[model samples]
Target: MRTEGDTWDIVSSVGMTALFVAAIRAAETKQPDALVHDEFAALFVAAAGDPDTNRLIDDPELWADSPLGLGFMGLRSKFFDDHFRAATEAGVRQAVILAAGLDARAYRLDWPQGMVVYEIDQPKVLEFKGQVLADAHATPTADRREVAVDLRDNWPAALIEEGFDPARPTVWSAEGLLPYLPGAAQDALFARIDQLSAPGSSLATDTFGSDVDFQQLADFQTEQMRDTSFGKIDIADLLYTDDRSDPAEWLTKQGWTTKAAPPEELAARYDRPLTEVLEPYAQMFNGMKYLTAVKPS
Candidate 1:
């Protein structure tokens, strides 16, 4: 029996690719075209292409008719891109993208020599991506490793089975995955990561802010999500713990020094004028949280 989270994860696996396509469009808007990711975005999309995934793009619908969705995803992408590059520069050599749904970073960034990227996702999703790249003859920039496992399962064991090094530092991301997991699962998820991560590991995630009425947000995305093969999976209770006490701060008390940036600040960072479109998100969702926590030396 597939759970609600399982349903939503697959949907996000399909839906999240829109951000890359939006990034490409944003690049075109730049004077000389400010492109941050590699050309592999298009290639990956083609390789992973399916009717359900392609429908949203072909429909000519932007995430928000305004700029909130596009702006949010864009700013967040560039921010993590910087943090990831910085981690590599600071000597962190391993990256594991959790819920690795449709992200093309393996073929995008110019990783230093010997950098390894292990992407973890559902078996079906993982198989699709691996096959796509192979079929397209796309070479990855980093030493690409794929760990096929459900995030809610004993994935740490699966990752260890895949030869993940416990002694090495790793950069990890939970981008857009928390929404489907139950709150208890969210708490336990990081504990598992803590057990595996060594000193100097870095993590980035977006959390639901205190102000956002998740129930309402769920109602908003329900229609849009329902129209696709991958429909909405509601787990409103799964959002980050409230109290303005961030998930990052929680990790900090656990020996990780954390830094958090609100969505407005992120929008400013990316030069996206999102006042009108972002008002709802800004007032709600406490402005869509982006947080990074690093294990201290």
Candidate 2:
């Protein structure tokens, strides 16, 4: 649980979730025909220097027990990878990754020349990621910029001050972010994005279903996390879990052409099926969609 004074860095609750995802990505990377490959992910885990995290990364059996969860992460990573590739190929040079935590896309992806990738997150999160990549002597494929600010703050101003050009087309992503924000904040985020985006700009995001009994699942997951090797961090504590509007439908009404798909469909397209054990978790993700929307030129 996060206290009011709890400042987040890479190892905290919400921030540590990034490391958890990276651990899964690292595990997937070892497999043949891996959907996504993050070369720097393993390095970040080792750099964390925590015994529990090290155990989670080292023990493949932990991920093997939840094949559906593992597959979902891989599919999600691939989906975002495809999104960025298409965006860059379409000549959208400016890209922003919201809450970019332990994401090595800038370092691993083969971005084109003259592309600028901006990563937005809290100051400590970005600072820690930079330090880890620096220690490993890794280099990004694009001109990467870091915008250190909280999403609840006047982040648009901070982003613009850090060289974001609102007049040009941009590709924006909000992966693993919305559920943590209050409902009103989520709406405000989209409003801000719409204001900053020029015609031809595109956005990609992942959202949870609004109909699920979130409190029930949050309680269940909280108990599960306590007994697991992942430690005592109840992720429920970090999430706002308020009812959020469907981003795809909302974006369409805002004049952007949008497409959405459930995780099952995306997993099948990648030749990875969700396992039976994941059904309970999937229910919580009911109506959960990976969405992409584009403003008309």
Candidate 3:
């Protein structure tokens, strides 16, 4: 369960989810046909040094039963990576990654000259990432800065204080974040992004479908991870799965030009069709889509 002012570190509660995602990315990176290669992901896992998590990533039998395994995460990573690439091609030099948990984009992506990437997340999470990368001696391709603050707080002020320029066209990403926020907070978050975005700013995110039943989704995920170490902390308890406005639709209503791509299309586009893997989970992801919205100049 979650509270109004809850806080978590790298391997507990919400923070553990970040480690889980990184583990998946690490597994994908080792694959011969990996869609996205995040070298630092494995490093993050190693730094945490959690035996169960290590086993989850290294043990083939346990990983095979995990939901949204390598294929889905690989395809998903590529989609977002392409979004950033397109943003750079379009001359957007500034970027912000919201809830940037264990994400290695700044260090991995070949950012343009003078590109600045701001990563926002909890203080401890950012601290952990900074220390891990520092120890690994990894250098970022872009001028990366960490805005250590909770999203539920006044993060806008913190971002601005960290030299974020609201006048410049920026590329923003809120990947795997919305589900953790309450419905009202989700709307507030978008409104803040809209307020801060300049003309020509673009945003990309992965949002749940309106048709998803939280109860069923939770049950399925719980069952799938029951035999693994991940099952101990029920993800359903961390998520606020109440009904909420569709992100693309909400952005459209806010006057942004939005484009949505279904997972099947993205999976096929990347040559990793998910039909068979998604069959059992079809209802849970019925209308889920990857959304990209642009604010017109």
- In candidate 2, stretches whose alpha carbon ends up further than 4 angstroms from where it belongs are 1-6, 67-70, 219-229, 277-279
- The weakest ten consecutive residues by lDDT in model 2 span 222-231
In model 2, the clashing pairs are: none
Error of 1 at 37 (Å): 3.3
Which residue runs of candidate 1 sit more than 4 Å off their true CA positions?
A: 1-35, 43-70, 222-246, 278-287
Candidate 1, residue 248: the lDDT equals 74
What is the C-alpha lDDT profile of model 2 across 3-106, one tens digit per residue? 54355888877888888888888877877878988988888888877666666556766546453245778898999999999999999999999999999999
Model 3, 39-92: lDDT tens digits are 999899889987777776676567574446637788889999999999999999
- The parts of candidate 3 lying over 4 Å away from their true place are 278-280
Q: How do the predictions measure up, each by TM-score?
A: 0.80, 0.93, 0.95
TM-score of 2: 0.93
Clashes of each: 1, 0, 0
Model number with the top TM-score: 3
Point out the higher-scoring one by lDDT: 2 or 3.
Answer: 3
- Residue 9 lDDT (model 2): 82
| lDDT: worst 10-residue window of model 3 | 275-284
Model 3 C-alpha RMSD to native: 1.5
Candidate with top lDDT is 3
CA-lDDT, candidates in order: 0.66, 0.82, 0.86
